[model samples]
Target chain A: MWFDILPSFWEGAKITIQLTLFSAVIAFFLAFLAGFGRLSKIKAVRFLAATYVEIFRGTSLFVQLFWIYFALPLFGIMLPKMLAGVLALSLNAGAYGSEIVRSTIISVPKGQTEAAIALNMTPWQRTWLVILPQALVMMLPAFGNLIIEMLKGTALVSLVTLADLTFVATVLNSSIMRPTEIFSVLLVIYFVISLPFTRGIRWIEHRLSAGRY
Target chain B: MSVPLKVIYNEESTKSIGNDLRKVAVQPIVNYSNISKSYGDLQVLRNIDLDIAPGEKVALIGPSGSGKTTLARLLMTLEEPTSGTIEVDGEMLWHQKTNGKLVKANEKHLHKVRGNIGMVFQHFNLFPHMTILRNVMEAPRNVLGLSKEEAMERAVTMLKQVGLANKIDAYPAQLSGGQKQRVAIARALVMRPKVMIFDEPTSALDPELVGEVLEVIKAIAAEGEMAMLLITHEMDFARDVADRILFFDQGRIIEQGSPKRIFNNPESERLQTFLSRFNRH
Candidate 1:
């Protein structure tokens, strides 16, 4: 049964990898801006970042995907279904990643900031030269985990008829008249996609924190 | 390649201000005219006017609520005055120099003016993520544009003075409280400001460590070439190093005079009782 389904699962995995990788890159870049915006002193900047994070995080990602893929067309806005699905994933994942980014930045010792200021570094210089590099190093593990979650989240896009891994799985199951075997194979494929990313982050965290402990 | 911790500071005197700057050589190094600060409704300081001659040692001695820390913070521009001006080396700082004259200083002006002064906090505010050598050399290489070799040489000499010359590469967490405070002094001093202000530098150290930090401070004062403002809880440290003591009470300078007079014969009854409680040998 496993051997029979391997070829079909392999086909499904290709689209899953593309959706996850494309969304992850977009989400990672947007999260940096959103996270730093939340830390901005200007009220408007801070409010905008907070509003974006809250609007995205408070709602379900699946609902968000549906709105982009299914609901936007009624408002006279037209977008490709595949494009809409990736946008929703990136936006939603960015909201969650921004919080992780913020907490990681704040966790750095305040003394480092004081030291930077004492050295007469401009605010921008301090952010990039002193703060952001350290913050990026700290964010990687959490971000890596988020990427894996986002990969799993791409399964919801199957409902939009994107022909992603989940959609292909459902089609194969119906055609072959075997729900349990097809579903189990689908689950294993998702696991195969996620587990290595999870382990990679763990290995990174261990290597970075190795001798510090 | 490094040594133990020593006296670190924000003012790296050796760079621009140097050890032998005369008050009148260029102009006044420090002038705080009618500076005031308030946190919400609680006014920490009001109507403070002060001037420090070059290389003079002024110690601020007061009870806990007497605005000692606030004064130090104000001078460092860590907290700006609600109303008034702060000038450094006779240039219009903490305020804009308008029409070839002085106007009320704002944040931008303070940024430039404050670049010339350095401060050391009581809690040692050392960068925990950085090693002691990096902490010592940061401002010099970054702000002062010192070559790595130059900053390292200064860092070593400063550490040697503070007696922590052996722990130069150690992290703050690895050092004792006294060691951390000394590294903080080196970090501040690396900038070579005209004046150095230490706010309760020894208060947080273990008793044994306090004396070591004080010894470094006393050596700084005795050098008699760098204007220093010290805020300390140690009566002996204050008396030993301070040329003059500004005894503050209730947000006011109750009295200011030579340490011998203030510590021995006080003009105010408030000072007498306050000093008496801790006046033990």
Candidate 2:
């Protein structure tokens, strides 16, 4: 049973990993664009970004997943299940990730902006060279937590008929008729995947923060 | 050895330039023409008109909230004036003439005109992520468009002037209050600004640490050709370094003259009382 379960679990975990990685790339990109937009001096840009954050954060992730997976096909636009899963996860996580990015950037001292301006740096140059580097250091810890949340969110793709870890586990449970053994293995696999990622993020956080003090 | 010789050479040339500058009826390097600033109903500077001569060191001594710092910030373009114009080297700082009329200078115009000025804040405000050398090097490389090697050399020389060349690799957090202020001074000087403004540069430091920062400022003043505006509470230091002193009270200059006249024989009762209060410290 262990040998038979191993191959299925590996295949399931690989799909899970792929969905998580793809969604993560989208989430990270949207996070910065939306985060910086929230801080934009232009009123329209700020309003749009704020609206994006509020809408995604106010609604439920389950409904959001369903909308991308099921509701979009109502308009005659059908996305493949995996891409839909990635889009749902990415959009949901990105909303939360933007807030993390916003708060970390705001936490940087006002004096840093003043110093950059005093040096006659253009606004873009100031953001890129001075404020962003310092803000990035502060953002790393929160970003680690966001990544873990994103990994957990990948579990929901199973409901969308994706052959992710939980979906595979469900199939295994029904076939084997041993819920205890199958679910236990599923739980262990999630932890096993998360543990190395957690360690890697901590190491990066340590290295980035070391030079400041 | 070469650095010290170069410093001496710069000093001699600056002195000759200073003399030649005085012989000609030179325009004021910084002309504050009826500048006024207010935040809501709270006015910070009220119709302030003054001129800073080329190579002149002007010290502004005032009680807190009297607008000395605001005046310095306005010149740095950190704060915009409510009305009136601040001209740096005869170019309008906050306004640009468009077609035939004056319009508020756009960000592009302001950045270009603002190149000739530098300022030091009470809080050292060094970029914490950068090492001391990079803090000094940043503006020159980014704003002045210096190459990396040229910027590095200038930053090293500026740091040496402030006596912090050895600490170039150290970050701001690793430095003391005095050392951070020194780095801030070096950071500003590397731009070779025509007008340098110091807003209570030593105020954030411990009493023992203030002397080192003040010493660096004095050395900077000795190198002529640039106008210096210092907003300071250190009366003795101000008197020693300033060629002229303006005694500020309630957003206005109550009296201004040579440091001797302002310090030894204050004409206005407001300034007399202000001096007595400072004397207690």
Question: Residue by residue across B176-225, what tens digits does model 2's lDDT show?
Answer: 99999999999988998898999999988999999999999998898777
Q: State candidate 1's DockQ.
A: 0.40
Best by DockQ: 2
Candidate 2 segments whose C-alpha is farther than 4 A from its true place: A1-4, A204-213, B1-25
Candidate 2 C-alpha error for residue A60, in Å: 2.0
B56-89 per-residue lDDT for model 1 (tens digits): 6888888998898888777776666788776666
Can you give the lDDT of residue B53 in candidate 1?
63
Residue B68 lDDT in model 1? 86
Please provide, for model 2 over A1-213, each residue's C-alpha lDDT reduced to its tens digit, 9 standing for 90 to 100. 555676788888999999889988999899998998998999999999999888889986788889988889999989998998888888888889899889988988888888888899998888899989988877777777777888888889899889999999998888888887788888888888888778978887788767664
What lDDT does candidate 2 reach at residue A125?
A: 88
Q: Give the DockQ-based CAPRI class for model 2.
A: medium
Q: Candidate 1, residue A171: CA error in Å? A: 1.7
